[model samples]
Target: MMFWLAFMLLLSAAQRGDAQWDWLTGIFGGGTTGSSTGQNDPNCGVAAGSRIIGGQYASQGMFPWQVSLQNLAQGGSHGCGGSLFNNEWVITAGHCVDGMTNPAMWRVRMGLASLQYYENGEQEFTVTKVIMHPSYTASAMGFPRNDVALMKLNRPATVSNYVNNICLPDRDASVGTNCVVSGWGVYDIQSQYFGQAPLSATLKWTYAPILDPGYCSQNYIWGSEMVSSIMVCAGYDHGQDDACNGDSGGPFICPSPDGSRWELNGIVSWGEQPCGAQYKPSAYTRVTAFKSWIQQTIQSN
Candidate 1:
């Protein structure tokens, strides 16, 4: 009788655990995600592709604020991308630095279009500190909430045509207009075996329109629960143009109404499985939602 009681207790615990897993799966969709990048390749080379699904190769110095976050743990391979917000700070996805917070083990490469090859104006900076959102909870099974982070550079980035800082959005900023996302992430999601080699070694970009929150939540297999108030969605329902692996923590840049400059509007957070899938749009951390928080953090730090 005692043995039977223990078995019942064990079964109950298992069921409860499964119930929680099921809930997350129902909200964020379920499927094993593949590697974020290929085995580390330090050699710089140009990528092969027409573009990011439908994007084009970016001209040198086009998006000067674009930067690459290199993982020294991964042999200096590009793990994720970021944007230079100012001389001393960069904004990226919190998930990008979740377990790899060692500042000495990371570096920021800016003013370069190619990952493997440094251009005439390329500059690399050592990271002094990493600050993730206090409420950030990185989950493999749930939406990446509060997915923003700031990296303090050891020295200020020299402002130039090829190394300018991107502007941030204000609290009242709204992005009804289409935004551009640039990165060196993989152009094809199915080429995981190729690893970092299959990725775009050169900078590439695609246009993803800002999606309505209500419509974004309803379309994914995980349903609307995957999208929180802090997140936003962009990409085609029937995938054509989208950002993929290695692109996380990059910017969703939009032009100012006056057309003189662009503002950082979004941070690449997470997306549906099999990136760029039909009817599956990618999600981003809405920058406006955290505008005040960003200000406070920068000031306090």
Candidate 2:
């Protein structure tokens, strides 16, 4: 509607929702989900190609950019994974629709693979509107900063087969660059503890250089400067990697046109703590620094 209130803000990037598009919004982390020590807790997710390890890289198409969304108007209740930029926009991360001003709560669930259980094609829409970033603010919780958001689908979104859309990153793309962030997130593997379902996670990969934001904020070189013009960072730090709970608003894609080509750079915002367990790096929200507020909020709705 209002372009899904500037991209369904949900920076915990962990928030998620979907009750069969009952409209409105709003995980599993520790214990029970598999057991064995929570199934070897690498964050949990063993086999279906592990879940949330963050460094996210192993790759080969990883479910062609998973997307389930399904009726949400309550802050990512359990909905996250967007990147389709056509037929009504869907490039998430404005904290997954910042606290709904209320457009009847919100609803959108397109083509699923696994948000719980859906196999034979998925599609559920009704988010009359949602378009955030009048200066997005996590407003609370560890204060991740400006984070990002986008959603607008009272209609439009009926791709086919494996659901589509995933490419953006070339507003001259390059700021200490390195991109590629796949979703349907969470990963650990081998030892065990894998949760979430939806295959093709052939162990998605890519965590290179990942820096931007005046040097990736030197990573809190004090904690502030790295606001990095709105966020866009990644990591390596000598250990496993991360990005779990449901890979929220997916797409940190980057490679640059002249750099080799691979647009859509930034959307999977929220990180610096979980996922990719090391040197703390996983921030995204610099889609070319908002590209004129996403073409002035998707060409004025």
Candidate 3:
């Protein structure tokens, strides 16, 4: 049933689902005063941002093989984005787990560049599955096709100096370089909670450019069910910044083609609503055009 109507439209677009408008966009139609203004505000709808200057134990400049995939990543918590093909693997956003497909409900918590969530923090693990990436379709959530996902972790994390991993998108990782899109998300788009607020951004590569298939299906507002070889787009057509919703999966890196270091060419999928809305750009999910379905789904697990 199309992944169970995308898992009941992803639990009626769970913004921590408790009630409010969102019976699949019926526009604030539930109760509890729009569900406590979407639970004390700041989820301004549609994928969103904030995470600049390398993190997660960021390095790679003076030695230690130039690290940083956010040292493994840390934000509001319970997974959204972090680790880029290393630390035994983590990467995220299969719709954050889309209807919780159970991988031990994912734990992963790495070094902490922000978002504490209680003392003695940082370094938590427990997943073991949740691959997603069979080529997500149904015209994806606005260029969300194959939104990307991983996880795996059931024992393999102990690289010090603050965790590691960050490199994956070198099948000629191209598209006008100069990237760097970390996460922990949130840059005050009206402060509804402002993402993780650990913040990170570099947004350039032509200030978010990639789409062109008839201009992403004649531009926005549901652009004719966008689909051009499986969707891809970038941001800043003169406004709106992104990586919203706790920064989905994370990583929009660059600098590879043998120039060495910094790869991960895309993962923070879906956009075109708020978190950088202005001619609506911001869309991803083209990790080297689906690197062979992410190495045959992580080598058939």
lDDT (CA) per prediction: 0.65, 0.47, 0.44
lDDT of 3 by residue, 57-80 (tens): 222111111112222233223345
Which of the numbered candidates is closest to the native, going by highest lDDT?
1
- Rate residue 94 of model 2 by lDDT: 66
Pairs that collide, model 1: 38-195, 38-196, 44-116, 217-224, 237-279
Compose the digit string of candidate 1's lDDT tens values, residues 239-298. 646776778898787665554456777888776544556767677788888877776776
- Roughly what TM-score does model 2 have, to 2 decimal places? 0.30
Which is superior by TM-score, 1 or 2? 1
Residue 258 in model 1: lDDT: 51
Over the stretch 1-301, how does candidate 2's per-residue lDDT look in tens digits? 0011111111112222212112101121212121111011121111112233333233222333344453343454445567655545666776655665354675555445444554454566666667777777753344445666667666655433333344454364565554456655544322223433332323244444465455445543325543656566665553244454456576666554544224566766565333444455566677767766766766666
The local distance difference test score of model 3 is 0.44
CA shift of 79, model 3, Å: 12
Q: What is the C-alpha RMSD of each candidate to the true structure, in Å?
A: 15.8, 17.9, 18.3
Model 2 RMSD in angstroms: 17.9
> Which run of 10 residues does model 1 get worst, by summed lDDT?
1-10
lDDT of 3 at 97: 61
